[model samples]
Target: MRVLMRVAAGVLILLLIAAVGFFALAWKGEIEPVAAVDRAQFDQELIEQGARLAAVGNCIACHTVPGQPAFAGGLALPTPFGTIYSTNITPDPETGIGKWSEEAFQRAMREGVDREGNHLYPAFPYDHYTRVTDEDNRALYAFLMTRQPVNSTAPENELPFPYNMRMILAGWKLLFFEEGAYHPDTAQSEEWNRGAYLAEGLGHCGACHSPRNRFGAIDPERHFGGGEAEGWQAYAINTESPAPIPWDQESLAFYLRQGWHEHHGVSRGPMAEVTGNLGLLPDSDIAAIATYVASVMGEPDAERQARAEALLAEVSQSQSPALVDAAPAAAAQPGSAQGDGAAIYAGACAGCHDGSRPQPFGGLPFSLSTAVNAPNPQNIVNVVLYGLPPADGEATSVMPAFGGVLNDEQVADLLAYMRERFSDAPAWENLVELVARTRSGEHKVAIRPSDGIERGPENVGASGGAED
Candidate 1:
């Protein structure tokens, strides 16, 4: 009985020790709140700098619900664990961060803690934010604090028990979080380092581009290899990129700035929001990001370079007046799936995507599209089904939605045909199912306007079908 009693005591003591240690790791003292500062208190220059950084961070995209107060924060972010709603960062005294001092905001950005000392969920992407310098954090604070405050509390996170507990995030951090400002590499150029800082830090590009492990931490080994965002495949920006034409710094800068490139099609999905926001950044910053990203992509191999060159030459030749009037790619045999798909493409896609006109205002040839060559067909499926909506009061690439017209089998057949015609990549498996899920909204997708190019719409996205 004495031995058993001692054993129980030992167990209890160990539990007590663990509890203490856990609390120690998790504990953060609340900072005293201060009255919201007047906008005049912050320097105009600093606030403007903060505005650019906020754009880099894409804050409005996540924090602002459509038609809602900007930065009011009611956007629902769905994660593997559950839906975590964004909190109001607006300077509302009661529900927003109005009372938060610079120190409190700094702590939240650097340590992923709230003013009240609760551990923030990783969904907030503070792992990347931790790399932001104190000066930058100050600027961000100034900018957010001066924003119009709206009295709104985010809906409670729908996370189940244990997962909903903020304490568990400390464990997650212990395993995955590395808290520090970005360290510059001596070997790299200043431009490269600047790009790296912004891309890896404020941009948090990896949060969406890099694949995550089961624990929801980015898989370090496969950084920038590729990942998914909002039901769309964020294609590999690294050397593993599926883009038939390799991305150079110039092309990347153009794409990032103009939202479209001749070699690559217009940005869509979450990336569309990114490019749209990036417009606020200066050309230098965009160039730096492109430089850094291009370095990450590295130089293409001899074989790939040769292929890209050949493809560019081929596309150029194909777009010439003589070939423009020539018949489209050969039709598949009649009474077959491939044939039906070919017919559909001829009627609905080839008219715009015929490579007869330049992109932005013209359809991008499938041969150059990253979506067509991607390992997964989710992006292409999305583009085909939902198409690009024209931006309000803006001239942009517009594609008519085929979801209302095409059935699952038809869409799948069409995509399969495009895959065979445009890319040497293997045919996608279970495409019909993917199309069905995306169409039925079983797989949720975030749709945004393709407003990258400033050119007036002409033949771009013309499905060659009668108006609805």
Candidate 2:
């Protein structure tokens, strides 16, 4: 027994030493780089393409905070581990990527290493960026390098021990990261391939739409099965979708490009940022993405799709108009604190979401609303708490923020009513707790919840259809 114990101790010591040595060597990356492009020479075409690519990646969305110069990164993205502040991508020599050469930039994107050879956290989404085409990478570099330099330092990362051991990421890359470029599928159509590349490579759509494992790495098996972002659930765009009017390429293209569609609805939460950024792309690029996503999330058969639309049109999106007009009845239990959900909707939501109303606000119907039928009721709760930020620049939204107005119980009541009336799905349990957590900012949300993005009062949400 004594001899066995000694052997085990020796093995453990050896393993620890090996791990320490391995980390020391691996942390200082030794990978070779491809030939560096001549950074001094770039043209308008590269700059233009880079701009388009950046829009697709929504690079500025994570890097910039409200009131900050674009790409002067300071936003704190909350993750399970800790807050990871985005780094400055501007051309500032002291604080931004200005000092990085083309070789260093490409290595950072391709191998998840920084200019000084330190491993970059995956929070930067270099995993997807690794698959970006070299041509696109060149363009992105050209575009980013030309940006006006902003002299600002992002806050230091606030990660805990072990997690903050940046060298440990070497193993994480070994386990989860793959180095490669987008490989076009020969069997698929050119349009389909283009869309796939955009969605999987540049768009990095899965970052939000796909759930992560305990390690904070995306579960590859889930693919487009819905995931959480900025505390809001990014709805599944696959067969798992519970949308009343099944999504097709046409409707999706309209939604992606315009930020709203008659069959669907206006984008909100993190999706709003995505849709807004996508608006910068050409119509053809948007259409290609829609096509690829539609293929993945094949629409309901023609019959069911048509029938669902017809039902929505006939119903004018009223699940229970009579309920809305009725007086509030006593709680099902005498002492229960639950309020009348229908009455609340009548006072708050009906003026716009009710189909009988006029253009943008009037046209959006609730009975067939996707949020009402979601597997989890988080989407509805999110919209109610945060409210759709008035999108004056794109699809102008009229929805008001109830986060300050309604208590948790009220939001729960409203959510229950929406689910019961619009969808046949089971009632969401523990909604009050959920609302409380969301309001208190305990939820790991990826959205920048605000009242409006326009040059006006922060709390003033638009209330009418947009002119542009």
Which candidate gets the maximum lDDT versus the true structure?
A: 1
TM-score of each: 0.92, 0.84
Task: Please write out the lDDT profile of model 2 over residues 241-331, one tens digit for every residue.
Answer: 7788888899898788766666676677778778878877999999999999999998588777777968666665343666434423322
Clash pairs, candidate 1, are none
Candidate 2 to truth, TM: 0.84
Give candidate 1's TM-score.
0.92
Model 1, range 250-333, lDDT digits (tens) per residue?
999999987888889888889988988898999999999999999999999999999999998888887765664444336656
Show model 2 residue runs off by greater than 4 Å.
1-40, 301-307, 317-339, 392-397, 444-463, 466-468
